[model samples]
Target: MGGGRSRAALVAKARESIAEGSKSFTVASWLFDKSTRERAHLLYAWCRRCDDIADGQEYGFRDGARDLKLDQASAKDRVEAIRILTHRALDGQPTADLAFDALGLVAAECGITREMCDDVIDGFALDADGWRPRSEGDLMRYCYHVAGAVGVMMAKVMGVPSDATETLDRACDLGLAFQLNNIARDIWDDDAAGRCYIPEEWLVEMDIPPGQLMKPAYREQLVQLAGRLVSIAQVHDMRARVGAGRLKFRQRWAVLSAANIYGAIGKKVHARGEAAWDHRVRIGFLAKMGHIASALKETMRGSYPPQLEPKWTRGQLMAAARMAGPVAGVPNTPLRDEGVRRKED
Candidate 1:
């Protein structure tokens, strides 16, 4: 990627990063071909690094994290640093960081563009700004930047054509599905971490006061909201399956398997109802294997057409990401990070 860095060394670090950052992803990645696997791992390393930097965590651990400005202040600085480093990585410049270097490598090999990387970085910028969704559209917009864009990059790593818009949308759908599930499962934890992704309108409708979501009196209402998030996730997951059919067998299998595994978390969270936040929900090993088996069976059958239409399209959300509230009645701009733009009215 840069002058002296060896691809092998970068790949090795990437392997370690994925192993430590996401066990589920590591398991799913093994299903990819060798070249795709390496590239996927490399891309994941950068994404993981940026996430950790944005959240003030190291390797996904958030314990005693306030010292890193987990809430604000330096969080904004951290986001800007991420943007600068990502820009460097996209430019083939040495960033003096393995994760950013890995991004440079993957972007070079896979045709990932500056826009794709910026789309993801936008999510971190939102978090840094202490921004929250005011509506369902806002929530999905956040999900698009954080996870959907990354999914599109992942599809490219799998050798998906740049012109495959629907496939890319499906890929983005999987990311949105995953993020929605995460929000459902981690609603309390995110609150504990001084963050919340649930839309303000939902909270107001439920009459759950800010920062009191976990209070015993409001637990049921919170569960209802969580269920809604999961319901939305399920729809995206279903549509994403259709997109998976467009991939090669192994890629499709890996994607559906991972989808099922993550989907299990949201289902379990919803099934638990009021008790969902009592402990963190996780898919067990046997359950993971079962999902994998189901995916294999699903893979054997020919791909099915989607039975549902998208409630929101990537193009629409991306357009939202590219705008601030209004600049002299001009909505679009080249620099679209959260620091440069506010949520549109």
Candidate 2:
């Protein structure tokens, strides 16, 4: 693959990757301007590739016939491979993999640092270590590493100033909300895979034992917990909306549409309870379109007020981010309110 051809191939591959892997995101991305949409697809390709590599799945679907084992040693090696390739890509070296090259392009265009990439990889490391959350804080920290950090990077890719710490924090909050919804919706599938993300304390309070979450007796308790997760997601989703208001109209519409779509998944999960996992919860195409319409309306109205206190502080979230390393150039400033507010205020 020569220079120009290779770049074109990489971009084509990225578009295919997103279309195959995430229908919701693919649909929402259409709202972005051409340049932003293409770059977002590039970023998504890299992210989807990393996730597939970590889970030993192809586009998130497992080959159940194969004897898939969760060997920590092997997982570590895979993580290392991901890191090496990613670093080479970040260094502007040829990695041969379109996903890595896409990452490099996005990094260069967005000023994304190695530290941000490392933060996302650290989430994979936790999975490799067979980590399970002991408390709400532990779960939220995991969420930050895996999803919130990516949100920050996405915000940067969308041209949010690096110095806009508050807006970035809200972006992180949206990712947190998305992951919480994912955890709630996938509890059964994750347990079947010999993993669980809900806090052990919550399970114990409900009198359920580890690895036995799917037991029929615990359904009610699990529903209550899922509801709690959705409630938290709702709060963060609203705060994220405020942050979205700061972007250009088209970008704002896209962000709000994504938030509504993901938030709808959480709401449906909460509504369905244990039955949510009986069949994977998803927002239908019609429901997604409805959200997109609402997003457009919200963008036009343009009235996002500052939020009340968030459950967690920006300092706490930043500390979690720093667990991987310094967030390159992000200031270590304290957030004014628990929630994100407009910069003008």
Error of 1 at 130 (Å): 0.5
Per-residue lDDT over 1-345 for candidate 2, one digit per residue giving the tens place of the 0 to 100 score:
111236567778999999999999999999999888888998999899999888889888889885555787887788888899899888888887888889998888888899889889978877877777776776777788899999999898899988999899989988998999888888888888888888888899989987778899889988998898887777777788888988988899999999989988898998876678889988899999999999999999974664554576445866755653422223222322234333354
Q: Against the true structure, what is each candidate's TM-score?
A: 0.92, 0.91
**Candidate 2: regions farther than 4 A off:** 1-6, 321-345
Model 1 residue 325 lDDT? 28
What CA RMSD would candidate 1 show?
Answer: 5.7
CA-only RMSD, every prediction? 5.7, 4.5
lDDT of 1 by residue, 176-207 (tens): 99999999999877887778899888999999
Write down the worst ten-residue block by lDDT for model 1: 334-343
Prediction 2 global C-alpha lDDT: 0.82
Task: In candidate 2, list every pair of residues with a backbone clash.
Answer: none
